[model samples]
Target: MEKIFYYFLIDVPRAMTIWAVLMVLAAAATVGLIMRPRHSGTGTADLAAEPGGPGPDGATPVGAEPALRAEEQRRRALASRALELHRYAEEVTVAAERSAVTAQRRRDEWLTAQEEAESAWQAYEAADVAARRVAAAAVLPEPRTPRTPAEYADRERYLHRAAMAACTRKELSVLQLSDALAHRNGWDPRRHPVEQEIVLRRTVRDSLFAAHRAATERERAAWRDAEVAAEAARSLREEAFAATAKAEEFRRWLPSSPSAGSTDGTAGGANGRVRPAVRWRAARAG
Candidate 1:
């Protein structure tokens, strides 16, 4: 019983170690097989030499050189086709990126152009207003030939006649428009006849309004011109007064005239005679 127990402890351990070592070896062998290069056949020239193994007449065996060459060519063709596909994919990607960049640039350019256009329009409007103001403020020349009261009366009469002519034309237009509208009920109000008549009436009315507005604008423009002329005349008078004052100041510094006792430049001195004085000339500007 003692010997049997000893064998169970020691021999059982040894047997287990042997089984473990066998399992490890088997695992290593399986891994090597999986990693190894595979082949269709180990050395099977009989299958490659011909479709059917060994001819019926039992001729000598042919080599498998043709089959080997065909397989090598197929592999090279497959590699070339894969490389071409990769190059095509790269080209497509580059084209897409370039298109995206170009579109973004164009969008920015368009936005910039729109901004420039708007700014230019605003500047133009500002310039126009400034020009108008400058024109309104510009000085007017004094009349070379003054107009007589009879000429002024004649001008007023002409303006009155023009106004009367405009009124007459407006009355004629209104009469024509009324006559056209009188036929409005002859056809459906929504139909072309009535609609056309309504459109014509609106057109006549708009024309009359436009004419009235134009006449008002003309009168306003004339009044503005008159105001500008008046302002210019006042400015001219002020400038004349300033010139006269400046001339008087210059006269005080001039040498004494022949009638004066002294020709000297200075004012009265201790000797009771004017000292040498500076002579001034009137400088006219062109």
Candidate 2:
């Protein structure tokens, strides 16, 4: 048993020495990995010497930082310009909206004004039509004439008579009659003497004729009324005479005799005219 233990101890020391040697190798590998630079596919010495690599002089080449800074500044300026353009677009959009709103308002106001004007025009047209209708219905006035000494008295007399006649008759308009007389007389008496004289004579003649016709019509109406009254009176007289004749004939033809054995005997007159007793009683009572 002691010999077996001694051999086992000697084997344990040998195993421990091998384990220590492997630990030392692992620590050396770890240190070498930490010191080595990471590389994709290039050699370490080539990567370090390259101008674009991370060496003291290669990290910042001549004019590299200044070029990058200038590029950064340009990018910043472009971004600022883009921001300003966006702001201007917003303002333009706002201004355009306001302008559009104002234009629309103006258009609406104009349309409203046009509508009002149209309404007013329609009203004016209606009024004008009404005025025209009135003018058409009314009698037109006569033109006035200048008076001359030669025809003034005759003209005055004619006018006075016409006015008086027009006043008497409701059918004739005074304005119309006066206007007609004035037109006939002529406005320029000196220039149109013959025409004025002729017109005046014609007007007088017309007035006289009208008056005569009116008088004749009145006389005719009176005659017709008288004829109708006479006819009616003749008819009444004829009816009265016929009634009287009928009454006399009836009195003469009435039977006066009662039949035999009647208590009330009919009386016979001396001339053979028979009278009934009832009729005699009635006459006496009356």
Candidate 3:
């Protein structure tokens, strides 16, 4: 009985210790697996495992990290391209809108210039006609004769007064009257004032014609500038549209990127700065 008791105490304890040690070893192994560190960049330890041994399928873990890294790099490149194209689209759109606005403003200015030119020509024509009528009266002789240059001044002044009496208050400006009467086309001291008026009529007619020519030239230049500006705006609009489409395509190809066409909250947050679809429509319209 004592031997039996000794066997149970010693032998049983020894057997329990052996089983406990085995269980402890298994638990320690499990803890080590749970606590293993992984690379932060790749979020994996496949490279570390490759040197130690092959996987359960009898293949090294070498193929995992490289393919994953390559895919990751490709996605990064797509993201960069999409961002760049979005900015380019925005720049081109702004330039196109500005050109359009400028073209409109120039067109309005051209119209105003055209109207002013027409009015100036009409006024000039009327002045010329009036001066010519007065000059044709030269067929009649001067009512008075002057013997000296000093005497001609008073006599010419008196004759000019008679001519002024026939015109309305605003028919001729004071400055215009002075310039017209200042020159003599061909006159003896006794020549009629009507003959001297011929020079005035010709001067007025030439001035009017010059103004009309200038106005015509301005209208032509304005039209040319407007055409150039319109063309530039159209070209930029097309470019912006193409860029926007290209960027959208890149975004679609990205695996993790939000959908540019999606109206969902997640997509909206991700695509906040770059609304490629909206811009594409706007550019097309422009």
Model 1, span 138-223: residue lDDT tens: 34432343466665555444433433443355522444434433433231222222233333334434454454555555555555
In model 2, the runs with Cα more than 4 Å from the true position are: 1-53, 56-62, 140-286
Best by lDDT, which number?
A: 3
Worst 10 residues of 1 by lDDT: 185-194
The 0-to-1 C-alpha lDDT of every candidate, in the order given, reads 0.46, 0.49, 0.63
> Where is model 3 poorest over a 10-residue stretch in terms of lDDT?
258-267
* Model 1, runs deviating above 4 Å: 1-62, 139-286
TM-score pick, better of 1 and 3 = 3
lDDT of 3 by residue, 125-167 (tens): 8867877787777667666655787667765775466435423
The per-candidate count of clashes, in order, stands at 8, 1, 0
- Cα shift from native, residue 155, model 3 (Å): 6.0
- By descending lDDT, how would the candidates be arranged? 3, 2, 1
Better of 1 and 2 by lDDT: 2
Tell how far residue 241 is off in model 2, in angstroms: 99
